[model samples]
Target: MRVPVQKQERYIAIRNVTILSVVANSLLTIVKITFGIIGNSHALIADGIHSFSSLAVDAMVLLAAKYSILPPDTRHPYGHGRYETLVTLAAGLLLIVMAIGLFSEAYEQLVGHKSPSEPTSIVLIIAFAAIIIKEAIYHYTVYIANQVNSPMLVANAWHHRSDALSSSIVVISVLGYMAGYLWVDAVATIIIASMIAYVGFEECLPAINKLIDTSINKDKRIKIKEIAESVNGVFFMHKLRTRKMGINILVDMHIVVAPRISISEAYKIAETVRHNLLDEMEEVVDVLVHIKPENTMNSLDLPQRNEITSRLQEQSIEVVEKIEKITLHYVDGKLLLDIDLPLNIIQNNNQARFISQQFADFAVNDPDIYAINTYYHGTVYDSPKVFQIDELHDFIQDKN
Candidate 1:
């Protein structure tokens, strides 16, 4: 299937931002690693490793954006959006692993009582430049992510910001080391690792929630309900359900309408509600509307057609055999039936009147049935005409 133009534009924006991330991180990784070895600063080396990890995250973001935009298929009917979420989870896990490694190395250096070499002024210059460059990349990538509404891209932006933060901590430790505070470098490494671990956990949480089909926020739910109720012909709504699939939302709701309205009108009302929601909420991708009658009990609780037919048979009415269709309407807290019968049942006026009288007498004491209308279809009737029990009641009263 052809992808929509809007989605195509969004994917393009994501691709551009991710490419920018990859280029920036690649340069920073090489610069940090090259200067760290020359200046003998393990902190700079660790920071460079962090930058390299960010490059991996950028690659994941690019791969995810590529597949996540694929149009839905039979094998995956809900589309490939969740692939982005999985990529985000992978990025988070990578950060966590990197953090653990950094912490262990820092702890070993602290325990081994190794004297750290003081970095030259050139390393300080490199660290300052890295902070500036990575911070700029973070801001730019985040702006693009917001424009395209890509969660994975947002996660990657944070990765860039985290690298910038680590570089900032490295600068502080280097300054302290130059001032003869040798323990400062290892402590700073541990601190930066802790921060990275925190951000990783933060990224993992939203992705995990999406994977489990978590609902949107309460405020969004209220707004969606208001929008649905604003549509014309909707008497009320209930059984509303919502869940997140990556950045998109899915909604399922039951819309109540008047029982007497035609099915087509009810369907039109449902369509209107769906359209209004899609217009108002940009993140919503799909809405399922179930039509129901207002002010009625659950249909399952009411008597079934077979049960009603059995009751009529017990009364010797024998109308079930001639029934072409049986429509049960629940209104005003009672059941009203419209039974379509063959025209042969209405042979003459006397037979029609007697049959209507018999059904009326059967309904008079049955509290479940408020009224029953019989419709005849055949050559004689030409058109299906409804004969209500109320008309029979009027005729009997007139005779009395």
Candidate 2:
């Protein structure tokens, strides 16, 4: 499938931001690790490791963007958007795992009898600078994520935010170490790890719900219902269902229209509802509208036209041949049938009444038929004459 221009733009945005993130994280990792070693601050080293996790998230975002931009195909009719969703889930899980590792290492350092000397104003400055840079990256990524409506990018943005938060802890702990509180650095590492884990869980929730095909929020559902029912010909709507595929929403609903309306008109109403939903809701990419008659729930499993015609032939073989049209109405768990016949077939009003009564009797013994109605119409001879080609031409000539 060909990629739309808008979708191509979104892919480009995701790629650019992710590449930027990779560069920033790479530099932060190198700086923090080198300074942590030189300045002897273990907490700053763990913060650098947290920055490393951001690099993994950036890689996933770039990789996921490559496939997620593909158009829908046979194997994946809903498109490759779920690839991004899966990446979001992985990013969240990665944060949790990184947090656990940080926590364990911090715990070990805190309980160990060995103590390291920290003598440096430089470590504090580096950690503080990391906070500013990571926070800047966070805001930039978040802007791109919202612009493209990419959840994977959003998750990646939160990863940057978690890094910034951890860096802030590093700043505080470094300050404490300088003030003769050596345990503050270890304890702060544990706190920073817990914060990362909390953020990881937060990111995981939306992705999990989407994976399980959860419906969108109740407020959106209500708004969708209102939009569908607001259409001119739609009497009401039911069975409205919605689900997310990546950031896009897919909707399916059934709308009721007047039973006697033409199929073309009913179809027009359905099309209107579909268009209204797509236009009103920015996230809704596709909609399916099912048109049904009012009181459809009370409808019955009735015999179709062919079967009913056959049964009618069984009842009155001679009269069945005169039927010009047959209309079947399935309502209230029963079938109401209307049969049209030429007026010439009936000798008089009494005979017409007799035929009506005779056909009406068919419903008495039949389980599916609720009522049968017979309509009589004048023959062509009794109505205005139709013009042939020659007559029409002569008539036009005469008028001229």
Candidate 3:
């Protein structure tokens, strides 16, 4: 099957930007590492390691963007968005490990009192150049990340930012060394490592939260509630749930409607709420709404149509054979029923009212039933439609 236009566009954007980052980081890594060794600048060498880490993260982003756009399948009903999140987490762990290793080496150099060789002007030029290039890549990557709304791309962009920051530290360390300060270079390396570790931890936190299906923030929750309640026929909403899958949000909620509405009406109300939320909230990709009657608690243990019919049969309700429909309504812990029947059983309005009273008297002993409304239906002579006796009575009373 062909890919959707939106996903296709997002993938193309991410792929192009990540490839750009990969190429830029590769060139910077080679230049920084080679020149740092030639000029004997340990801080510049640490900066090169940071660049190499960026290259790894870029590769992961490229892979994630490609696979994350695939449509959902049976094995993965929610699609492959989590693939990007997992890759982001891996990138963070990788950066943290690299930071620890660099920190330990720098600490050893400091403890041993090894005098760092003074860096030539070329090392300074390379450090400055790396800073400029990495900063540029950061801006470009972050821009694409926002346009695509990809969390993985955002993490990768920040990785590029951390590289630029480390290079800045390298520049400072080299300048201080040239000014005759021996300890600043090693201390600067340690500082760069600390920064790398901090950024790594920051990147890991959001990914971990997403992986565990953490709920969205309070403001978003409140907004969602407001939108759901705004829809007509929704009495109220509760049990709202939200979770992040990559950049999209998944929502599940319960809504209350009229107790006596038809199943199709309730379903239509639910679909309306779903469409409203999806239209109003851009990040929400899926919504599951459970519809419940307003009198759910009162109706939970109430007898269904089968049991109610059996109970009415036990009462020997003779008119039951003529009944067309029996609708049960629950309100305030009591059942209200509407029973429809043909007009042939009753000769006049008085008999119609008596039959209604008869049904009520039978249920008067049962505390579960609050009331019974009887509708006598007759076919109009001039029309092919049936009219209820109760409606005709109300119309006559209005004419008087």
Model 2 gets an lDDT of: 0.81
Model 1 lDDT vs. the true structure?
Answer: 0.80
Give TM per candidate.
0.84, 0.87, 0.88
lDDT of 3 by residue, 94-153 (tens): 768877876776787789887766778888799888778878888988888888787788
Where does candidate 1 stray beyond 4 Å? Answer: 1-5, 105-114, 301-303, 306-325, 330-334, 340-353, 363-370, 375-400
Summed backbone clashes in each candidate are 0, 0, 0
Please give, for residues 1-400, the per-residue lDDT of candidate 1 as tens digits.
2233498788889888888888888888998999999988877887898899888888888888888888788997778889899988888887788778868877887999776667788789989999998889889888998888777877788788788878886787778777888778778878888988888898899899999988889999999999999998898788899987767888999999999888899999999999898878888888999998986774556677788877887787766566777788887677888777765555455666677677778777787888877765544334344444344444334433
lDDT (10s digit) by residue, model 2, range 291-356: 898754556567889999889889864678888898887776788887877756655556666777
Best by TM-score: 3
Off by over 4 Å in 2: 1-5, 113-119, 298-300, 342-351, 377-400
Displacement of the residue 9 alpha carbon in candidate 2, Å: 2.1
lDDT of 2 at 227: 93
User: Candidates' lDDT values, in order?
Assistant: 0.80, 0.81, 0.81
Position 113, candidate 3: lDDT: 82
